[model samples]
Target: MNYRSSELLEKAKYYCNELSKHHILSKYWYELALVLKGSTARGNSDQYSDIDLVFFCDKNILDRIVKDYYDEGLISREDGIFLPLPEWIGHYNLESYDDLIGYFKEKNYPQIWEYTNIIILHDELNRFSGIVEEYNNYVFQDMITDIKEKYLSLQLTLDWLRHPLKRGDELSVILHCSKIIRLICQLSYLIDEKTYPHDKWLFYYLKQTEFGNRNENKIKELGKNIINNSIPLQVDKELDEYSQYVLAESIITDLKNQIQLKYGNEPWLDEWYSFV
Candidate 1:
């Protein structure tokens, strides 16, 4: 049950070798590709961690391989479809390397991390590695810009929702508090120059970083309280008769100031204040 990265890589290799035993797969062995993703690739894997792999091949070939395994009882139908390949990919056609890159780029940060952190088991032309290199070298200015915009927009929404929250609208209170927690987590990752994973993995990813480690327990508690429709003690103490939304706003502002102090001002900061 303990899933080490080396063991996971070996398992992937074994699967590739098994697939290669088939005449059709053997003929296209070089074209068959495997990538180790998720917690294992990040080196934060645990006993319960799921092994996520990305298999790149023609759709028909993938289908045949999966079906063969299923028919032979080597893998359960669910295991053949879901464990090796997630159910989400069923909706998309990802046969080409270009298509894979496009999917990775367009998907959320976790998926991008998966693409960037892959260990290609077999790539004849070395296409997969080249694509990963391109992504790694690409400028992140646009991504930063997008995050800044989202932060500002959420701030504005929180500002607008403050009145309803104070008016004792339960839904507004929950939504407002939730947005603050999310904004802070996103800003923390952005300031650290790390890609923020999806929301479910946000705190887990945060715990793995130095920045998050300092406030890991605090953030975890705050996140739980937010989900349970309660305000964290720290936020309540800082409220000072102001609504919870204001506390959230001030936290984000303080974070912005800290980032500015550490990294100095950029055009984005100027633009952010211009809107404020």
Candidate 2:
């Protein structure tokens, strides 16, 4: 659980900066870049939003330094709750800029966005200032990959729904609907060209999208009809299932069109079929 803090963010930066100056704790670490990330850097700190310090040093040594600060009564190891003036520090580290870029290649675009959204607590030489375009290219490619994977998954789920729909198995159909809804949310993030602000904040972000803004009511109505069978008995059950079936098919058709329109020129990653 993240606790909301009005003033804790600034305080965490000041103290950590001072700590990095100390030789006993910082050692050779001060030569590397120190970044403040996560909620605090993003300006959305709650009580549990521990100061996420990404130290660009040896990963093993980063843990030891965080432990050293914990021993000094400057920062707490646990969530900064119940303690007075707690700078709950959570630490992550990368060895160098190359190591950081390696992380970009491995993560989802949304997560890669999080890594790039950082506050430089200590970087005397400004080593990280030039990574903006490099990261942006990585994010764009990652999103394309994510969209392709989602398109494939959506196709599979639509195919899976056929059995449940034919059997009039309401429970199985609703369960499949839930899975599709999750995919829709994920796909919407890519289509809308918005970084996923994480699941807890999904609804907050979703409403801001043009697609979600317009279709919110229909999505909710369809959700209720599928999940709870809330429509009156006068509403035919078979008709309801058929409606869901059409919606799934429509989603697939629409998403394929969106993909082609947005990324038609992107070279295929690999050719699965050829006249050999």
Candidate 3:
């Protein structure tokens, strides 16, 4: 842990310790497990970032605490301390190990990634620690299949949009550009073996990674221009008379080539262009 992480962890520890003293939480205090998650645990947090914590305890106890404490706003901003209160507080049941296993089996990689990336603050019986271990050990072959399907679907959509774009449909052209941005971001995460962060952190994560950092500005500018229903002048100049869209098709095609070169060709790629 770096200085920031250590600082965040200390704050979380203090908050959890105070929270454990609540009448509703006191009974399960010793048994409860605490974990630091999100950007803080991932070591990517900054001054503007907020800490996220998860507490694992009995389902019944958690339910009661949710009703009597969290729902009641007992843990609120009224208390001023070194750290802002947890941005998110998640409660998992220690007894319901099956749910965690089910998330992994169902290829819910985001949730699994959340658990695996956590920093354990407390785990009296090692229940939460064991779940983290399980997440780390789980195979993700199914996740790769899901990503490939998404890539293929987006590729097909881009192909279909070409006709409308050639007919001077601005909406179709914009949609095409937007989907290209999405596909590139998705492919970057797939190649990195990382879960795609939620939209709030999507661009941040993209620019922070090695592969994405190179095209980060291009992706952002192109995506913004597309959303605004316009194409970049440079991109428009690159579009050949035979091409359907005002924006350069080579942008997306080049990204596809990079994915193929880096990860090797997928069988779906051949099928993807077959319909085009």
Candidate No. with top lDDT: 3
Model 1: per-residue lDDT, tens digit, 181-257? 77677667766766677777876677655546656665555445443346422322323454454456555566667
Model 3, stretches more than 4 Å misplaced? 1-7, 58-61, 67-99, 142-144, 163-176, 207-210, 227-248, 273-276
Candidate RMSDs in Å, in order, are 6.0, 6.5, 5.9
The residue-level lDDT of candidate 3 at 136 comes to: 57
> Per-residue alpha-carbon lDDT of model 3 for 1-276, expressed as tens digits?
667766776777777777677576687777778777887788866776566766776566555555565456654432221223545432222223455667677766567756777788778898777765666555456555766766776677666665654565667766777667676776677666666665566666786555587778667666655534354223223235423343435555656676677668876665776633
**RMSD of candidate 1 to true structure, Å:** 6.0
Question: Among all windows of ten consecutive residues in candidate 2, which has the lowest summed lDDT?
Answer: 267-276
Comparison by TM-score, 1 against 2, better one: 1
- Pairs in clash, predicted candidate 2: 3-46, 3-47, 3-48, 4-46, 4-47
Provide the lDDT at 111 for model 3. Answer: 75
Candidate 2 TM-score to native: 0.65
lDDT of each: 0.59, 0.61, 0.63
Candidate 1 — which pairs collide?
none
The C-alpha TM-scores of every prediction are 0.70, 0.65, 0.71
- Work out how many backbone clashes candidate 3 has: 0
Total backbone collisions for each predicted model: 0, 5, 0
